[model samples]
Target: MLFDKIARPAMYRLAYHDPEVVHERTVRLLGRVAPALGPVSRVYRTDDPVTVLGLRFPNRVGLAAGMDKNGLALKAWPALGFGFVEVGTVTRHAQPGNPKPRLFSLPGSDGVINRMGFNNDGAEALARRLAAHGKPGVPLGISIGKSKVTPLDEAVEDYRFSLRALHPYADYFAINVSSPNTPGLRALQDKAALAELLAELGRTSAELGGSTPLLVKVAPDLTEEALAELVEVCLGHGVAGIIATNTTLSREGIAPADAHLAAEIGGLSGRPLAARSLEVVKFVHECTEGKLPIIGVGGILGPDDARRMLDAGASLVQLYTGFALHGPGLVRRVSRGIAGRPC
Candidate 1:
């Protein structure tokens, strides 16, 4: 409540100046201090234990990818009340990503638009950091992506390299092929490409014998036919689960006051994404007859949104733009709500 009423407004004012600056500073500050303040900065902890993808999550709410691209503030997340934290979208090689002003806030619609292009310090860096600091209190899922310089034909080897490097650290792996910012990245989501990629990754996991669950993060922009094909490919390749509905390229619900910002090319997330993301989750859940677990993400802003996602058959829910907007308090609220609800 304090965050929504007081701190959030102050942050909004700062956001008007430079959102990325505030973001980087916050992550860095938290990265440096969170481990030390671990016991003191803690919030609500729910015992609503549920196992998905062969791992137990303390609660349903998790910190989504992109917020901690390089895992800098990893230890801070569980203290802030996230049941789990998915880090990176890290690539094989370090890259600066797109030019500045790549991240934008649409205050009017309570949304964010970003074309960050998977900017990070690379997978080996993250693995080394995790090795030094250790994993957070909760489950840590590592999301891996293709590097910009890597050709489409060699994407398999590219992803394989990162997976091999970070394999020891990740509790689970999220294969990201959804972000619109990366050119030709989404092409990997196609049937043949997806099949080949997952088959090799599946083989890699088998070779490791770790049984680390592999979940694919998909875009909300795919057609029904395309999604069905992707689902089939996942099953064929032995994928453990799916992280349905990454950011959307569609600007359908941007508030008119913020419609001008819609012209900026990137994936749009937050409230506008709630409906479509939920739709995709429900479709996937129904199609799979709830056999495959789904990590619901995209537009969740509060407990109600999280509830709707869970009710729609998502086994878990993740927050990104919503967390950036409402602060960590939102995690407690959502967790409590899910905990108190009848199953």
Candidate 2:
């Protein structure tokens, strides 16, 4: 208990570097030791079971994508007691993400900003990892996006290629059109493009003859009108669920003094995202009239943030920044907070 109490803060301090650097170090170190994660690592593992999107979740809290971009820590992450893990915003072609200083921290505000721009090792490598890694006894969500240099015109094809490469490995797939770092990526979020892309992907997934769930991860920057249209598009195309927010470009509610790296060219996540994410979740819930499942994300620092999302209409929630700040204990805390609460 004493170790856990002191360790989270220190680990968080060490992690406040560039996202890509932190990411690479984590993969190298954990990848070396992950295989040694035996019974002792089960300290935070939870037994609570949840069924969402026709998939069984070991718990309700998940580690959102961008944390384990290559699916490198698949075996180890679940040991952290996360009910689910979303890895990658993988593209069809591997590319180095945005140049350094791509991640920044606002230590005072407990937030982070990153323009890492999807620096993944590509879909095929991730597919290989997924194929090689043992199952974590929980569902895994694989998020895919367009390559950095991919033109808007062929974005669908890029996604299609990635989908094909990653289909076998992902239990569920999240179409990520919301990341702010990628140029013209949000254009896919437009009604017509979204409809055409998703319809085709839906058909393709159907042809695979497996029960893979499909989710769309939306941006927090979207206005009510835009969100409503996206909701309509999702429902019409039979989207299985919506990850109610990626990061935001908004700096509202943040004092200039506290905005350590607010000007950083990336999406802002953590405390700054709490209010808008809840609002987006609520909008998606009411707009769908509760038919669609929304995975609440952004902020989600502690039980209160998790509870806010659930109460506002999230079926489940994912956290990256929060997990970094507070550590794996959050999964148990949030699960205990939500257990037997409601659907």
Q: Which candidate is the best by TM-score?
A: 1
- The digit string of per-residue lDDT tens for model 1 on 1-343 reads 8888998899878987788887888889888888676564455666788888889888888989999999998888888888899999999999999998898899889899999999999999999999998999899999999999999999999999999999999999999999999999999999999999999998888888858999999999999999999998988888889998899999988999898899999999999999999999999998888888999998888888999998998999999999899888888888888884543
Report the error of model 1 at residue 193, Å.
Answer: 0.3
Error of 1 at 111 (Å): 0.3
Off by over 4 Å in 1: 39-42, 340-343
Candidate whose lDDT is highest: 1
Clashes of each: 0, 0
**Against the true structure, what is each candidate's TM-score?**
0.97, 0.94
Query: Where does candidate 1 have its weakest 10-residue lDDT segment?
Result: 37-46
> Please, what are the lDDT tens digits per residue for candidate 2 over residues 117-202?
99989999888877777555578899999998988998988988999998887889999999999999999999999999999898
